[model samples]
Structure formats: C-alpha cells, structure tokens
Target: MANTNLKHSSPQGGRLRSAVAITAILSLYSASAMADGGMASMCFFITYMKQIVGSVAVIAIFVWVMGYFEKKAVLADIGQYVVLGCMIAAMAGWFVSQAGLVPPSCSA
Candidate 1:
C-alpha cells in the first residue's frame, strides 16, 4: 500500500516540484534582469507593442466568444484587455516622448 501510494503520487509530486523550481528560476531571472534599469526589456516592450496588443486582443476575443457560448459568466476579459492596452500605450507614449522620438507640445 505504501509503495502503491508513492508510485501514484510521484508523478504529480514531481510535476508540482518542477513547477515550483521553474517559478523560482524565472523569478530570479526577472529580478536580476530588472535590477539594472531594464533597458533591454523596455526596448523590447516598445518594439512589441503591436504584438502584445494583438495577443491580448485575441485572448479577450476568445474569452468573449467563450462567454457567448457558455452564457454563464460575463465577458470581463475584453475590458481588462482594453485597460491593459491603454496603460501600455500610454506608458510607451511617455517613454517615446522622453526619448525625444516625439516632441513635446509644451516647453517647460
């Protein structure tokens, strides 16, 4: 019985352990990467705005469609996507303005 229980639980336990290990590794990677100024990630984020927005929009549409078919839960994902998109766009715009890619309308 103990052996059977161990056999039965090993795969699931291994998966959980691996997941936790991966999470820790990724967290460390991101923390170290961001310990500086995050110049690379910021550049990537700016360059990939369209891809990010499209990916999020696709997810939102998928959720909306699922909600349509399911009809049990409201499709709140689209709103979330819109909010995220707007926030990213605003931040990107700010970064661009700071980088002097776009000139400020007003002088300080």
Candidate 2:
C-alpha cells in the first residue's frame, strides 16, 4: 500500500495560503475602520495606506532587481508596474483626503 500525503510538502503553497489569510484579516479590519468614523479611523486609514505603499515599493524593487537579473518573467514586471500605478493613485487619494477634499463623513 502506498500512502500519499502532499499537503505540507510545498513551501510555496504554504506561503500562498498564509498570504491569503492575512489579506482576508486585513480586509475585515479595513471594513471595520470604514464603519467607525472618527480621528482613530482616519489615522488607521492613513496607516493602512502607508503600509500598502511601502509594500508596493518593496515589491517593485524586488521585481526590478529580479528583472535586472533576467530571472523574472515579463508578466511579473507588468504586474509590478500595475502595483506601482495603484500605489501612486492611493497616495494621491490620501493627499486629497488629508486636504479635506474628501467627504467629511469619511475623512473625519
């Protein structure tokens, strides 16, 4: 009899599962933050945006370095560029919110 147990054999799979879990948790937190409007919510939103921007920057740099080494696929490069664009848009939105351009209900 042969027994095949492959669930824990792939590190990449484990990492992917962990990433999904973290994303789900953060999304729930974000929803709650939106629901709770106040100075604390504003601060949480800003902090979350900053964390996203930082993560994007890190991923972009990693992809750039990998591309330089000719180890990354073109699709990865494109994805990184897309993420960079989103990061830029997010930063702009944050600035606008800070400038009181956003609705008081959300920004306050």
Candidate 3:
C-alpha cells in the first residue's frame, strides 16, 4: 500500500494569495473612498491617478522600512507588510484628498 500525501506547498503561492487579497481589499476601499467623497472626490481621472500613485509610493516606502528593520526575508512577512503599508497609505491618501489638497484642475 502506498500513501499519497502532499508534502509541501510553494512559499511564493502564499505570498501571491496574500498580495491578491490585499490588492482587492485596497481597491474596494479606494472605490468607496471616492464614492463617499472621502478622497479627492474621485470624479476626475487625474486626481484619482495622482492619489493612487502617491498612496502606492507611500505604502512601498513603509513596507521597505519594515523590511529594513525586521531583517526578515520571508515572503509571508513581506506580504503582511505590504498589506499594512497599502492600507495606511490609502488612508493617508484619502485624508489628503478630502482635505482639498488635490488641485482643482484635477476635478472632472
């Protein structure tokens, strides 16, 4: 008799899943932020783009800082960091946009 069991799964697969989940969540959040006039009003394309780009940059910086301090090279850790970073950045962007920081030219 032979036993069939799965010994292991790829680490990257886990990271990929985490990243996808975070991306979807953040995307929905962004949409809601716009729908409710929570961030940049989202009525204009340029403003939306700027908000997304800026938020992404902020998130990446935060994630990089975490990577630097933890010295953890694990994919799961990085994935978690990425999720946190994006959430924080999205919140920040939403605030900035709501505060009327976005230019009028950006309004549609």
Best TM-score goes to which candidate? 2
Candidate 1 residue lDDT tens string, 28-69: 755665775566544443445545656776776677677667
Candidate 3 wrong stretches, greater than 4 Å: 1-6, 38-108
Each prediction's TM-score against the native?
0.34, 0.49, 0.34
Q: What ranking of all candidate models by lDDT puts the best one first?
A: 2, 3, 1
Candidate 3, position 66, lDDT: 69
The TM-score of predicted model 1 comes to 0.34
Off by over 4 Å in 2: 1-27, 31-37, 71-76, 94-98, 102-108
Query: In model 3, how large is the Cα lDDT of residue 58?
Result: 67
- Order the candidates by TM-score, highest first: 2, 1, 3
Question: Which scores greater on lDDT, model 1 or model 3?
Answer: 3
Candidate 2 matches the true fold with a TM-score of 0.49
Error of 2 at 87 (Å): 4.6
Counted clashes in each candidate structure = 0, 0, 0
